[model samples]
Target: MIRKGSQILMEVLQEEGVETIFGYPGGVVIDIYDQLAKTDIRHILVRHEQGAVHAADGYARASGKVGVCLVTSGPGATNTVTGIASAYMDSIPLVVITGQVPTHLIGNDAFQEVDIVGITRPCTKHNYLVSSTAELARTVKEAFYLARSGRPGPVLVDIPKDVSNSEAEYRQLKDVKLKSYNPTYQPNIKQLRKVVELIRSAERPVVFAGGGVILSQASQELTEFARKTQIPVTTSLMGLGAFPGSDPLWLGMLGMHGTYRANMSIGACDLLVSIGVRFDDRVTGKTDVFAAQAKIVHIDIDPTSIRKNIPVAIPVVGDCKISLSQLNRLIDEIDLTDVPRKRQDWLGQIERWKGTNPLAYKQCDLIKPQFVVEKLYELTRGEAIITTEVGQNQMWAAQYYHFDRPGHFITSGGLGCMGFGLPAAIGAQVACPDKLVVDIAGDASIQMNIQEMATAVENCLPVKIVILNNNYLGMVRQWQELFYDKRYACTYMNHSPNFVKLAEAYGAVGLKATKPQEVESVLAEGLSLPQPVIMEFEVDKEENVYPMVPAGAPITEMLLA
Candidate 1:
């Protein structure tokens, strides 16, 4: 059948099972928007192009589907760079569609024209510039295929305005075959045997899981492997929900701000089975001293990431779920009867570490940020889909609120973007309308994308916004207090807007809790509301996250509060 490039694009989106798209309309892509209006697919009109990408990212993470976003040329395309970088760093699958100037106007400094493909080349997994309407269908098919395949990352498809206006034969391309690209999903049997041998021989074994486990949907396999081997499990920030936080074998997050037991265990373990993790700087701390005592066995689908950070004893290159399933099957054949008894001493030591320096904050008359997170967790019964803006609020949410399942706790772990939470929560709520979605944000960070409250209100998404109002850029202030002789330069947010009134202005419910006594009541009221809400809590300005490892220091070397 013959169709316009714009119509073909919409049909391809429908073929890809895209129920919604987060985007901003512009002059170049007006044709595409006109076509979109006729489709059943929902388009979330965001305040900023960056929010569109972030909302798509959140939708992808929460729904375990590839996120789709669209924007016009020049600044519209440029604005998505930050969000694209964030998604790239974390391996989120996204297909960003950007409009381009007409083919005839190309390379002549046409109005609203920019080399977005070049700009996003470094950040995206792959990118394309569709030159004609004939290649549009194939290019889009390849774009989505590339976005979700291998080590999933964002992919951009820049369509010229003239292409969308032109007609073409509409062909639904299925089963994209790229001979150059094929991720190894099956693990080598010899490597599995070696890993099994390490598990059986080692008395102190620790299973370190990362975001890859969650991305691969291998949480069940990871949990089962850890349980069957009787090994203690710890995860990177992105790996929060891969293992149930309430499980006996589970240790809290491991890294700079990780729990004492988790940090100490990583440093002291004899065998470290790291899976689906890149051993990022935040998690490794001083790489020289990190896991010095452990003989590491790294398992990841990305071969380059296996030994890039820290040298590994056994490197298995395969998908997380596939590798874990094989490991489970191999272990089933092994003599693992004595595993628990052999690791008693190791488990006991971990318990002692947990008991001595448990994650805690002093109870005070002023509202504590940690207290707010804990209360929010309790009120929600740890079932809410939590997204977070980077800073003290993100760390506090990671530490206090335990996640028992995958896709529940979504945060920008790699890029540490500040304005991520609100838009992400908006997308997550859109993906899971029946679920309670909350954005744990800081006073300073919340303002970054506060305009998204209007998007939520307009969509009737009941996303809860919990702002830890500390009156400062809490993380930077903490670093300054510790290293810069308390010269809090430009960190104090003294002239911040009244968040309650801000939310009200956006046509959303607004609530505030000034004192400790008002925290729970305000939270209850805000949470119970059936509309978007901004619940701001006035917290202690000087409070810092505990068990923080200084930069370049070993993970074990923590500055406890």
Candidate 2:
């Protein structure tokens, strides 16, 4: 039977178990939208193309599935760039479909025409421009496969307007065998042995897990390995939920705003077993000096990420879950009953670091952002699926929230995209309706995509927005305060609409808390509402996130406030 390209795409999406899609229609995508309406898949029409991609990103992060988005050509396709790039950096799996101008107009610079496939080539794991209907199903299959396989990332498929209406004999290809796309899932036995030997022998050992663990759904294995080995674990920003934040052995997030203990532990460790992490510049302050005293064993599915940032003594190339499983099996073989656990001293030192200068902020008449997050965590009992806008709000959320489950904490780590939380919360809430989803946002960052409130309101998603209203761009202001001698340029945002009225105008609830005492009550009321809400907390204007490791400085060399 012949099928239209749009119909074939829908069939493939159904086969892929896609339950929902976030998209915005345009001139080139009218047929696709028509087909979309005929399918069982729920279509979320976002206010902007960027929100659609971001919503898909959040859904992917929250559900551990390949989130999908669709948009039209030219401006619609271009708007998705940042969202796609954000997903790429964090290694989130996404299949982004963009509408393109009909084939004959390809290089003619037609209306609503731009080379999106070429535009997103660098950011996407892979991309294709399908001018013919024959390749539609196969290309989509390939796009989804490439997106969720190995080191997960975004993939784009540009479908010309003409192709959507064209006829094709659709075929269901389950075994998508791409000759050049083989990913290593198993690690070398010798290298795995070396990693185990180091772990067994080292007295001072630390586990640094990254987003790879979460992407592979290996958090249970990660937790088991850490506990069995009696090693403390610290996660990158993207790896927040990879291990239980409430676990006694779990150190807070490790990076520029990492806990003092985590940074110091990494600095002093003899065996740094880095798992599923790319040693990005933010995590490894100075390349030469990062983990200088440690014998680093880097395990990852992508070989490029292994030595891309820092040199490692052992590089085990394979999937994180598979490699860790192998290491765990071998660890079970070793008779460690004779060798006593020698990590007590190291644990004690980390505890000392934790005791000396912990993540703390003073409570005053003005609302404190840290206090707000802490209260939110307390009220939610660490069960809420929390997302964040970039800046001080992101850092504070990371520091305070205790994520005990994988897929419960979603945030933009690598791209540090502002206006991420609100739309992301929409996606997360849509994915897990029964769960509480909140976006911990700063006053400045929240405004970046404040328009998303309409999406939430229209959908009646009930996603909570906890805005840390400090009347300034908190993070950039912090940098200027410390590094540029308080040359606060355009960071201050003094004049703003009353968020409560703004929420009401959008057909949602809005509440504000000016004092520390009113924060909890305001939060509880907002969170309990049956509709979307924007709760603005008037936090201290000059308060800055501390235990900050300035750029280029050693992670351990932190400036504590």
- Name the best candidate (by lDDT): 1
RMSD of each: 0.7, 1.0
Off-target runs (Cα >4 Å) in candidate 2 are 338-340
Query: What lDDT does each candidate get?
Result: 0.95, 0.92
lDDT of 2 at 142: 94
| Superposition error at 121 for model 2 (Å) | 0.5
Worst 10 residues of 1 by lDDT: 170-179
Model 1 clashing residue pairs (backbone): none
Model 1 gets an lDDT of 0.95
**What is the alpha-carbon lDDT for the whole of candidate 2?**
0.92
* Cα lDDT for residue 269, candidate 1: 94
lDDT of 2 at 302: 95
Residue-wise C-alpha lDDT for candidate 1, range 1-561, written one tens digit per residue:
999999999989999999999999999999999999999999999999999999999999999999999999999999999999999999999999999999999899988989999999999999999999999999899888988877899999999999999999987887888889898878888998999998998988899999999999999999999999999999999999999999999989999899999999998999999999999999999999999999999999889898899999999999999999999999999888788889899999999999999999998999999999999999999999999999999999999999999999999999999999999999999999999999999999999998898899999999999999989999999999999999999999889898888898999989999999999999999999999999999999899999999988999999998
Instruction: Kindly give the number of clashing pairs for every candidate.
Output: 0, 0
Q: Write the per-residue lDDT of candidate 2 for residues 14-59, one digit (tens) a residue.
A: 9999999999999999999999999899988899988998999999
TM of each candidate vs. truth: 0.99, 0.99
